[model samples]
Target: MHGLVNRALQEFVKDTYGADIWGEVRDQAALPFDEFESMLHYDIRLTKLTIDAASAVLHKDAASLLEDVGSWLVSNPAQESIRRLLRFGGTTFLDFLQSLEELPGRARMALPDLDMPEIVLQTDTPGRFKLEIRWALDGMGSVLLGALRGMADDYGALVVLEAEPGREGAEIVVIDLLDAQFAAGRTFELDAQMR
Candidate 1:
C-alpha cells in the first residue's frame, strides 16, 4: 500500500516538477523512488502538523490568559446579558487573534521571510467579527483574505475580509494581478451568514 502511494507521489512530482530533480532526490535519499516520495510527503505533512500543534498550544495559552479577564467581565456587577455577550465576544476575539498570529508562522514554514501586516479583530455582533488587516502585497491581498475567511469560517461564522470604500472589490481582486507597492487596509466582517 505504501509503495503504491509513493509511486503515485513520485509520478506526481515527476510530472509536475520534472524527472531530473525527482531522480536526484530519489537517489540521494537512498530509498526506492516510491518510498522516497512517500517519505517526502510524510515529512511535508509532518511539518504542517507541527505548525498546527504549535497553533493549538498558542491558542490554549491565549485562552488561559484571557480566561480570568473574560470571567471578570462577564461576572461583573453589570447587567446579566451584557456580561454574557462581553464574555463570549471577548473570548472569541482573543482566540481569533491567537489563531491569526500562528498563521504567519505557518506560512513562514512554506515561504520564509514573508511579510504580513497587523491583523486586528472587532466584533459588531454575536458570533461575528470584523477583521482589519493591513497587508502590503499588491495582488495577493484578496486571495490571502479569502483564505483567512475560509479558516475563520471553520472555527466560527462566515468572515468576509475586503477593502474599505472605493478601494478594491472582490471581483476586481480575483482577476487583477499587478505588482504594486502600496499598503492596503481591508475589512473582513464575520457573521452568521449560514450558521
Candidate 2:
C-alpha cells in the first residue's frame, strides 16, 4: 500500500508536469495513507486539519486567523444551524461526525483541495468509527493542509489534537472536551470551512 501510494503520488505529479519532476514532486505529493490518516481520527479530524491548514496558509497571523474565522463562524447563521444540529444529534463524540456533509459548499466551488485519506477513529467506542473525505477540484483550494494536525474529542473534557503526518500541519490548539458545550465548539471549528 505504501508503494502503491507513492506510485500514485508520482503519477499525480508526473501527469501534471511530466516525469521529469517526479523526484521533486514525489517528495511532496507521495504521502502514504496510513501515515496520512495516522494523525487523524478519520471523522471530523480530517476536516479540522483541512480547515486549519487552509486557515494557517491563507492568513498571515495564525491567532488572528483562528479568531477571525471562529468569530465569523459563530456569527454566521448557517454555521449556527450546523452547530445546533451537532448538539441535537447525541452525546458521544462520534455523533458530531455525522453532519460533515452538510458543510456549506457550492457545487461550482473547488473541493477537498486536500484529499483526506480514510481515517479510523481509534477509541473504545462500541462501533468502530471511520471516515473518508474525498474531493474533486477544478483547481483553486487551500494549499495549507500541509500544516494542520487531526482533531479528536474523548467524549470527555479533553479534545485531543492528533499529531499531523509532518511538522507542517496545523498546530494543537486547545483541548476543551470537558465543556458540555464541546459539540457546539466543534461546530464553530467546522464553521471555518464556510469561509
Candidate 3:
C-alpha cells in the first residue's frame, strides 16, 4: 500500500473521530510511524490492521469508514491538490467518469513507484456508466466506490451507485447519473472558468 493511503486513513480517523482515538488505533494496529510519507510504500498488512482497529473504535463498518474517507479526500480543504487533479478531468460529471479510465496512468506519472489501481469506464447507455477496478489488494473496493461517490458530489451531480460481483481481481461499479437540480448553473461556471 502507498503511504498516501495510510496518511489519509490516519487523517480521516483523526479528523472524524479524534486525535486520541487515532492514537489508540495506531497503537492497536502496531504502527510505529506517527506519519506516513506520501511517496513511500508500506506493508499492506498495516493498512488492514489500521482499518480493523478503526472499525472497532468507531463502531462503523470498514466500508462506511472508507466511503467517508473518500468524501474527505475531496471535501477537505487540506486535500486541495487531489481535488484539483480530479477537477482537471473535465467540467462535467460524465467527463470526470471518463477521465477515471486514465487515472492509473496519470498517477504513475506523478509517482512512478506507486502501484495504482486500474480503472475502466464503460458507457453502454447515456447517463449511466460502469466502472471496473482491478486492484492489487483486497478490501479496497469500498474505497473506490467511496471515491466515486465523492467525485459525484464534487461535480454537483446527482448519482446512484450499485456494486456487482466481479471476476477475479476486479470489481464492477455501476453509476447512474440522475437529473441534477443545479447542474446547469454549475456547468456554466465551469465552462466560463475553462475559457
Candidate 4:
C-alpha cells in the first residue's frame, strides 16, 4: 500500500480519536515506525494490520472507521486541501457527482504512482446515480460513502445514499438527489487571493 494511504489512516485516528488512541493502534499493529512517510510504499499487510488494530482500538468496525476517515479527509479544517480539490470538480453537487468517474485519472495526474480506486458513475435516471467502486483493496466504497456525504453538505445538496454488495468484490452505491438547493453551503473561492 502507498504510505500516503496509511498516513491518512493514521492522521484520521489521531485527529478524531486522540493521539493516545492512535499510539495504541500503531503499537497494536506492530508498525515498525512511528509515522508513515507519505511518499513511500509499504507492504499491504501493514495496511491491513493497521486497519484491524484501529478497528479493535476504536471499538468500531473497519468499514465504519474507514468511512469516518474519508469524511475526515474532506471536512476536517486541517485537510482543507482535499476538500478544495474535490470542490474544484463542480459548482454544484450534481456536477461533482458526474466528475467522480474521472477522479482516478485526476489523481493519477497529480501522483502517477498512486493507485486510486476505479470509479464508475452511472446516471440512468435524472437526479439518481449509481456509483460502482472497485479497488484491489476492499472497503474503499465505504470511505466513498462518507466522502459523498461530506460533499453533499459542502454543496448544500440534499442526497440520500445506500450501499450494497456488488459482484466480483465491487461496491455499489445508489445515490438519490433530493434537493439541489437545500441549504447555504460553505463558500469557496477559486482564487486563493480572493479568500
Which candidate gets the maximum TM-score versus the true structure?
Answer: 4
lDDT, model 2: 0.32
* lDDT of the structure predicted as candidate 4: 0.91
* Of 1 and 2, the candidate ranking higher by TM-score: 1
lDDT agreement with native, every candidate = 0.37, 0.32, 0.79, 0.91
Name the regions of candidate 4 deviating beyond 4 angstroms.
Answer: none
Question: Please, what are the lDDT tens digits per residue for candidate 1 over residues 124-164?
Answer: 55544444545432222333344443333333433334434
What does candidate 4's lDDT look like per residue over 45-105, in tens digits?
A: 9999999999999899988998898889899999988899898899999989999998989
**Candidate 2 lDDT, tens digit per residue, 34-68?**
22332233333333443344334344443443333
In model 3, the runs with Cα more than 4 Å from the true position are: 184-195
Best by lDDT: 4
Residue 58 C-alpha lDDT in model 1: 36
Candidate 2 minimal-lDDT segment of 10 residues: 138-147
TM-score for candidate 2, please give it: 0.28
Q: What is the TM-score of each candidate against the true structure?
A: 0.28, 0.28, 0.87, 0.97
Q: Ten-residue segment with the worst summed lDDT in candidate 3?
A: 183-192
